[model samples]
Target: MEKYMKNLTYESVLPFSEQVSYLNGQVASKTIAQNEALSLTLFAFDKGEEISTHESEGDALVIALDGTGEVTIDGNKHVLHAGQSIVMPARHPHAVFASERFKMFLIVVFPKKGD
Candidate 1:
């Protein structure tokens, strides 16, 4: 698996939200885990920060951990706050924007054989 945060040990209990930090005018991301079938990432976005619309090869699940944000999927916008979550379907256009400084967990799952 590919790890983003150096020196961070795995299989230990810790706060997921505190693992990544928000930076002014920038989006910060930490890859928790990455493999052929799945990828887990943590993100912190500053107010007004956004990820441009794009398509993914796998389905993406975004869960808000703190503050507010918006996820636009296939031209529709959905507002989200702490404890909220939304799924972006594979090969569909989607984007993420922070209404305020926010933290989130993103899990992307690739299609498996015989599914």
Candidate 2:
């Protein structure tokens, strides 16, 4: 859902984890905000669920919020637990897997024209 807008303001503070819930045997996602330059998304994955390998045009930062997960980038694997984070470079092939029920925040930023 592309409902959240970049310039909107929230009236009250809310917990990010409570915004999305994990579904059994599936992965769930919520888009927190997005614009031409950046996007913010929250994801919840049940045990054994995964996002298949893919490439992105923008750099992405993955922040683990709960449980544990495995992130494979360019054929290398990294295990991440709560409070850990990793960056996936633009155009690199990457994938995400949940070792256990997990939640994470993903921030992706689009590169400007030229360098």
Candidate 3:
């Protein structure tokens, strides 16, 4: 068998939020997989930390794994808590802020090369 995931234990049960750890005043991330078609990442943010406005070529889905966070898309703000999720469309401006110590799982899907 081939492995498409990394930085994580295989064949085991685990919580996604536990994969990454929060820092005192920074954001920490763990990349589980990355390829042209998709990307999987886990993020932990300290209270008040943020990822400023940006645009991506792919659609990004954010799954709140722990605590609370703010997701701003197209200038509108949306709050997310544990067990919640939101999607930022491709080419749209978006940002993420930690309302408190927060953890999230991010999955991005890109268009195929010819599409």
lDDT of 2 by residue, 2-115 (tens): 445543346767776777899999999988787778889989999999999999889999999999999999999999999999999999999999999999999999988784
* lDDT of the candidates, in the order given: 0.91, 0.91, 0.96
In candidate 1, which residue pairs get closer than 3 Å at backbone N, Cα or C atoms, i.e. clash? Answer: none
Better model by TM-score, 1 or 3?
3
My TM-score estimates for the predictions, one after another, are 0.87, 0.89, 0.97
Which lDDT tens digits does candidate 3 get at residues 44-83? Answer: 9999999999999999999999999999999999999999
lDDT of 2 at 47: 99
Candidate 3, residue 54: the lDDT equals: 98
Q: Largest lDDT belongs to which candidate?
A: 3
Candidate 1 stretches with Cα past 4 Å from truth are 1-8, 113-115
Clash pairs, candidate 2, are none
User: 4-103 in candidate 1: lDDT tens per residue?
Assistant: 5453567788876899988989999988778778888989999999999999889999999999999999999999999999999999999999999989
Instruction: Evaluate model 3: give its lDDT.
Output: 0.96
